[model samples]
Target: MPENDVIAAGARTVIRLPRPADQAEFLARVRDSAALHHPWLAPPATPADFRAYLERLTEPQTEGFLVCERESGALAGFVNINAIVRRAFLSGALGYAAFVPYAGRGHMSEGIGLVVRHAFTDLGLHRLEINVQPGNTASIALAKRAGFRLEGFSPDYLFIAGAWRDHERWALTAEMTADGPGAGR
Candidate 1:
């Protein structure tokens, strides 16, 4: 957890910045996970899209991390923090997707915990928020597991997949993480 160094390793997963070398493998995983993602997520399944995705994440206001299996160095999933506001209100929005053969294995839960810690301690972010579709129980569960509390709901909060979708807002403050959720457990 150093300046501009995006790596947070855990017992099973390693969360690090996405690289150009990961294009082929990441795209392959995205294609393989089509059904698993579908309406919930539409990651870059094509090489061109992947490049664009990477470019966007590399911007000053965003961060993209890949959760890789520690043993084999295979991609497990991805987490992106977008719209980071660093002045008075240090906050960002969280988005994540798990690839095939790795989904439901709890890698994301662990990676998210690491990311949350990094965002609070290293990045000096005061708050983080996750917006999940109500029908996506898995995403909601992941957020809750990472200590994000239910904040509220917004109807048609975002436009995705050709339609406006309602989303449940879940958030966690750095103070909350330091005091209760991820303090000493």
Candidate 2:
């Protein structure tokens, strides 16, 4: 497959794994949206960190992708599937964030839907989970829109923004959705 392909929805946006060449663009977006993302995705992200981040995405144990606007070809957001476990339980964690410019346009939701499909069908994962901070209403809505059910709140689940923040766990199982794994394909 090409480095990135545009996913068709009411609004066209490209979704695919980020290549090494995209590092500069990714860094620029992070810098530009520092204020909006700092609370959740703080600074101190050096070039090395970004390089390692991209490398992790290509690793067999994890996968990640960037969302871009088709018309402008700008880096709008990112999504990741991490902590893949293939033992008794084939499961992984889902994480995503969109730039301020792309927020509330439903682009992240569309990208997430495509990634969820690929995760279930292509990756053969049985379950996916997302943890969102209690205050992140946009992210919470994205999870719901993508069919993740709210499981419960996790106290001091993650240390973000210099403190341990509470997160609400949301999950989606392949068997729970009609279009999930082993449905027909």
Candidate 3:
């Protein structure tokens, strides 16, 4: 969307709202990242899917963030906050992926930090969680690196690919973070 919609930024990455104009490049990146995403994630790959994804973001409970390289503005990956609960809960779930060219380059690590900061500060969220399949070690590592603690495990937590998958729940509360709540603002 607008360039000014940046939620957060680091030295190498920037997180912002997804735009319709990014469809072509986004699809291509998804296609390229399919191998890495298999059995774990299934992001929007076609125009119709992308459109539907965008439409979902219009809802108050959902937010989609496109992580791009700061210097070149290349699509590094995507991180979504879904099923946000306000009022008593003030919590949200996280889902993220890094494109092939940017994977393992430490871009997503920085991006995840930015997302956590934005959720705590800008969004005024008190807690955030990431439900990742147990087999996905990389995703688990990312969550751990970003300061998320393993909460528990759920059998058949989310349906992915063709069947239900077991997942480990990782969480971070504002008070548990260094830059989170009670930090400065």
Relative to the unseen true structure, what is the C-alpha lDDT of residue 142 in candidate 1, on a scale of 0 to 100?
A: 95
**lDDT tens per residue, model 3, 46-153:** 999999999999999988898999988999999999999999999999999999899999999998889888888888899999999999999999999999999999
TM-score of 1: 0.92
| Candidate 1 error regions (>4 Å) | 1-6, 179-185
Model 1, 149-173: lDDT tens digits are 9999999998877789999999999
The lDDT per prediction is 0.88, 0.79, 0.92
In terms of TM-score, the best-performing candidate is 3
Provide C-alpha RMSD values for all models, in order: 3.1, 2.7, 1.5
Q: Which TM-score value belongs to model 2?
A: 0.87
lDDT of 3 at 18: 90
- lDDT (C-alpha) at residue 68 in model 3: 91
Task: Name model 2 segments beyond 4 Å from true.
Answer: 1-11, 181-185
Candidate 3 — which pairs collide?
Answer: none
Pairs with backbone N, CA or C atoms under 3 Å apart (clashes), candidate 1? none
Higher-scoring candidate on lDDT, 2 or 3 = 3
